[model samples]
Target: MAITEIPKGFKTLLPDEANKREKILTSMERVIKLWGYNPLFPPTVEFLSTFKAVDEKFEEIAFKVVDRETGKLMAVRPDFTPQVARIVASSFKDEAPPFRFYYKGKVFRDVEGERETYQIGFELIGVNEPEADAEIVSVVVNILENLGLKSFQIDIGNSEFIDGVIEELQIPSPTTFIKLLSSKDISGIELFMEEHHISGERREKILTLLDLYGREETLDKAAQIFQNEQSLSAVKRLKEILEILKSYGFESKVIFDLSERKGMKYHTGITYEVFHPLLGCSLASGGRYDQLLKKFGRDLPATGIAVNVDSLQLLLERKGIFKEEKKDFYIIDLKKERKLAYEIAKALREKGFSVARDIIKRSIEESVKTAFGKGYRYVIVLNRELKTPHHIYLSSEKHFPLDDKNLIESILTAVKEEK
Candidate 1:
């Protein structure tokens, strides 16, 4: 057999890229933690039935394999919210309202384009108030800003309004129209309506949904078009959520889009999509799913947002903001000086310095070149006898000797002075 490739839509991040990814994740964790959101670890694989329980549609997108032990189907997690919901319903069954969780991991799906994606997201569970929705929006803004993303927009919508309109209109096969609306394929929706012989006031009202977007005033225009009480209430809820976001000073970051039903399958109420100019698709997307926990044998309201970590990393790269700071010290240990070099390296690391010991056998000159190439600021050379004052190569081609007793302090002082 020929050599098999690693399959499509999968990427391996080299050390530099991986370092940047970790920095992005760390920044996101810091912001989320500031808001009191604790971390949650959901299993990467779960019973296939658990996923189908929330949305049968997931069966088409989720990857599955038979469990060797149980002889049952297991699914690689396609989404975090469902697994989180399962945990909340079963593990935290007795826990009170308002459980906030933040997660960072890979979600697998048998998608046509990308099979796996990195996601950093948060979930707010057991709250039905508009405040919960506003919190989700605020958290998204905070994370993006903290990550140094200067240009981004959050599009907001109410899935309940779309569902209610479909129910009130008694439209057949609403799913197709929902897809068309999600893509903003207005012409396709019009064609679909025409094909279904849907005209008159009903068709016009459905068409009006596409036009309801942009600033806060759009909510006023939406209320005038919605006839169903549920749809009206959804608009009111969205308006109230916007008011809350406004109070948080994120009003300008939001745009109302009633036609956005992308997550309609599981999202029961308000939905949102985060976009940046660097990518055509959303950088993150999430919404309120009040009924998702019910599938796990509990009733709870929840809202969540999942940031496309890989995409955000790309944005940072394009903006030249994702950079890995250089390591502080690279110590070259001659074969005979290994033990002493190890001791010095350990002590440096204990004092909060990034220290690397060279285990590879190379000449002192080659080791110095390697250290500079690897972006290390200071290079310490241990001779065969491991002399008391080791040779130190400073950044400006200056060479000096640092005694073993003053190694840590001298290196730190040099670093601080350079800074």
Candidate 2:
């Protein structure tokens, strides 16, 4: 088959795209590191049982293979949380409590088209306090703010909150409630209530409460409607988290969603999805999964978030957030005064300037046009004439310089001043 027909849903990232993605990833890593979270990198493949130990349903979406030597089943990781759990259990078993770690890498999943995706995130283990939860949320908010994402909402929810309410209803079939909640199907929940001899008043009230999703007011309404003590306590905890976010001055971006419950089964506490208006879906998502570490024989509490770098790039493009301006530089002559040209380019490069040499034997006009086409603002003409020295010409303005050093410095100064 031809190279063009290699496959679908797999494409290369050009220089510009790659640069933007790198900026976002670097920003996220810097933010997480600032919050005292150290970095860790696990292998891309692990024993299939590692994932299955947490959720058997992952077997279908995971890409499985057989170890040629041991004949053991292995699979590409679909998520980072499970692998981090296994690592903590094996290596850090005797370590101190509250081990915070971060990671950034590619994860594989058999979704609609693409089987591989880039996931940049972190995992905090061994800390279960409310302070730890607040710290995680603060880190997420800071990272988003630093990315220049102005208008986004962090919708926070608690699994125990919704699950406790369903249990308190004493419904004959809890599985139906789980399905209804998972699907966000209010009508299905109503039908289940009607079939189970639940009161119409209670069913309608609960359905209306599920739809009331936004801000701290949602928690107030939830507290009023939920009769279960555990569920009400969950609401209180969410409110406390909101208050902590406010103390960090992130109240404007926080939103409380009581019905938001779409994560892995291990997430037992606060869960959230960060949504921006430009991107229809979430750009980042994560929550507190205190019980996940226990499965690896290391019982501890942890909460963290993962930013979808590619999704973030998409959002930035849609919002016109990141616009890269090309650097201005001069291409020195290769024929006469080659040493002088090299010296000129070296001097400019040391000052954090971009300089290119015309070694391709192209004409001056061709080189100028090439520079302009590549987004360079100015082009420098170099020759061995000191009496009437070389000069820099801007694409926008037509100006000639009398001296070589003055011309080069003028171009560099111009670019710096523009910025």
Candidate 3:
């Protein structure tokens, strides 16, 4: 038998990374909950058909297995929105409108080989209004700000804005147009139009307009080239959304990208991606998927956003924002004064401090050295033979008698004040 090697492009998170990741995730969940978005946990594996209903491309990268007894094909979920939609359509059909739910979990996607990705995202279902969009956008912005991330931009785009323009052109197999738009391949789009014998002043205008890819001004430029009512309506919607974002005071962080078109197959209206100076890719991506609920037998509108927690941690680390604080410990000598030591340790523990009592019957020097080496700040020494009471010793200072009971309170109070 041969010994197997560890997998590539995948690594375990060590103590430091795990601690930072946990803190960021906790903050994200806290903000999400504060925004009235309840948490939901869905299974990591589901039937293959559940995901295929959203996009066939998912099947290519999905890890699949066959049930031994039932012989049903199952897949590890590559995304959460599909499963979330499945849950809502199945269980919350009779529930009221505007269901806001948040989730944080691992999603498996086999990009090259089997790789597991973790993401934290939220879904706002049964609400099509711009207020819901603003709420979702604002929630994400708030989470990022709360994480202490600076120098980030949230680029907003509308799928319908581009789709409406292409629909009016009646370009057969608009996949070419979509690809060219997504890749910012202006030459390819022009060449394709030429091959299709699309020669006119409007064609020249559209080709020139593809370069309009940033800021609110781009919307006006796109509106000029797009004479189709559907395209114009999409432009109007984009402007309205931009206005909403501005009203939220996130206008500076918000930028418009007309050529930005990822996740467009499932997304019906507004789509957004968050970028930062440190990340090579977007830290988070999401938008409205109005048609997702319809697949689950409910014809309701919905939208969502998903933050890549792993990527977010990377950004935070690169920005030097997520440094872990040293753990504080209170060490007690249980052997010297059993009763007093237990009482002091119990008191410290009751105060919500991490208390590590030294049970070893070692010399005072050995205990003090051990506690100091182990990163304990305060060491309480109890001398049973001495006439005086227990004395608390600071690692920075020498031992002293603390005769007063209020001294313990004073020490804790001082520590709290320092923090």
Clashing pairs in 2: none
Error of 3 at 217 (Å): 1.9
Which numbered prediction scores highest in TM-score against the true structure?
1
Tens digits of lDDT, candidate 1, 58-111: 889888999999999999999988899999999999879789999999998887
Colliding pairs, model 3: none
- TM-score-wise, the better of 2 and 3 is 2
Ranking by TM-score: 1, 2, 3
Q: Which window of ten consecutive residues has the lowest lDDT sum in model 2?
A: 396-405
Indicate which candidate wins on lDDT.
Answer: 1
Q: Which tens-of-lDDT digit does each residue in 82-201 have in candidate 2? A: 988889988999888688889988888877876667878887777766677778778888888888888988888888877777677665776667777777887787787778878866
Model 1 bad stretches (over 4 Å): 1-4, 167-172, 198-204, 384-389, 403-405
When superposed on Cα atoms, how far off is each prediction in RMSD?
A: 2.5, 2.6, 3.2
TM-scores, all candidates, are 0.92, 0.91, 0.87
